[model samples]
Target: MEYRPYKPVNLTAAGRDYAVAMVRRHRLLETFLVTTLGYSWDQVHDEADRLEHAASQTLIERIDALLGHPDRDPHGDPIPTVEGHTHRPAHAIRLADAAPDIYRIARVSDADPARLNRFSGHGLRPGQTVRVGEREAGELTISLPGNDQAPLVLAPEETKAIWVSPAASAGLRGPASI
Candidate 1:
């Protein structure tokens, strides 16, 4: 968990609570901006980061209610509850690490907007069921559910930014389209 070399930090109970609160605020704001204010998935993260610092608990709760208590944000990240409990699927794995099988995208890293835009262009957003194919030279082959075109090859950086869970539990057995 160390982002810096030779630096280690652990969370105390209160510290954990604070961390969750900040995350909760961030995700809730992202949900609101996308679902209500018409922000694209690629546009909400930094906006949410800024808003999370200024939004009050009451405002976040109201946003949560307004969004009908969304379970996940535009990036497919689990939104923590007001109680600070979050549920990330146990089977969720980075796309690069996924076995060759059908999987529903669960989340994508929000660290880069350019990557997000590229993923969206390739139909790689959360809830999209994709088939993982061969791997070679740090790239993964991916195919959309019903596409007949050549498989899309995701580079290592893209795969590392994407996560997926098995498709059966996606609750999208008969999606209208991919």
Candidate 2:
């Protein structure tokens, strides 16, 4: 239980293990809720938050097995393995930082439910391919597959809230798995 003044504290080995276990529980619950229970990405956080504290390890493991050991949640965040290993997408970049090209949606921040709902309304979810156009006036223009090539004008917050990777690098064809 030692910490430096005015510095971010690093977790001890035991603390890290506990944190990882909780994260595993929460993420497994989130994936189960989304994949099995038909819950949307935006709706699983609160439910997972409540359930993570109460869910037993056996239950979480069962849920993970039922999911066929998915490595990512609905929002594309990596799910830690039983050994506490996390595999992050090596090439993921912020949507704001992406060059003008076609890219697969790698991840989206679930921090803002209203914004998440808006994104969902626009059919912007993980694994969806989007065409990133040039940025203008502090906003970025992005286009989906349909919509007659109309661009979705997004503020900086919207752009920063998403993550994308080279669509070709991942071998993701026509909006692959979520």
Candidate 3:
């Protein structure tokens, strides 16, 4: 038999269903590990990647139920539903290109673990309010909402990896709220 690489489009209905199931399991596990176990967002991906293939469907469902069937993973990526539906935000834009204003960190791509660690160290995470500052020389400045701490300067890649949505009101100066 000639060996061929599998492509997403070539999956049969059953294959697609199984793939989605695995994805849902992986993402749910990632969320559970981070929120319930105190694992950092960047740390859960590898663990989930290892466990997802080994966990049974029953085990995955139990984990999902225990986590209240979370909609988003630790990194703010949407989890595919058992029915294969996803709820991605339509207005999410790259932090680098976002207009200077108040915005909520919607999602941070977990493609780079190092960048993820840096973001977490700077207290940047999903749902946090931030004030977008000036963009210059391929870097973007952002300040925590209402915090006196110095604004964090992020490289274009760093900023681009983050997604944001308009925040009702976030300012460079004000009281900080988690």
Q: How many residue pairs clash in each candidate?
A: 0, 0, 0
TM-score each candidate.
0.88, 0.91, 0.85
Give the whole-model CA lDDT for all candidates, comma-separated.
0.87, 0.87, 0.83
Query: What are the root-mean-square deviations of the candidates from the true structure over C-alphas?
Result: 3.5, 2.9, 4.0
lDDT of 3 by residue, 1-178 (tens): 2236783346777777878888898899998888889998889889999989898889888888898888999888899987899998777888978988778888999998988998999888988888888988988888985568889998888988999877643322433432
Off by over 4 Å in 1: 1-7, 168-178
Indicate which candidate wins on TM-score: 2
Tens-place lDDT per residue, model 1, 25-60, is: 999899899889999889999899899999888998
Query: Lowest summed-lDDT stretch of 10 residues in model 3?
Result: 169-178
lDDT by residue (56-128, candidate 2, tens digit) is 8789989989999998888888889999999987899999899887888989998888898999989888888
Tell me which of candidates 1 and 3 scores higher on TM-score: 1
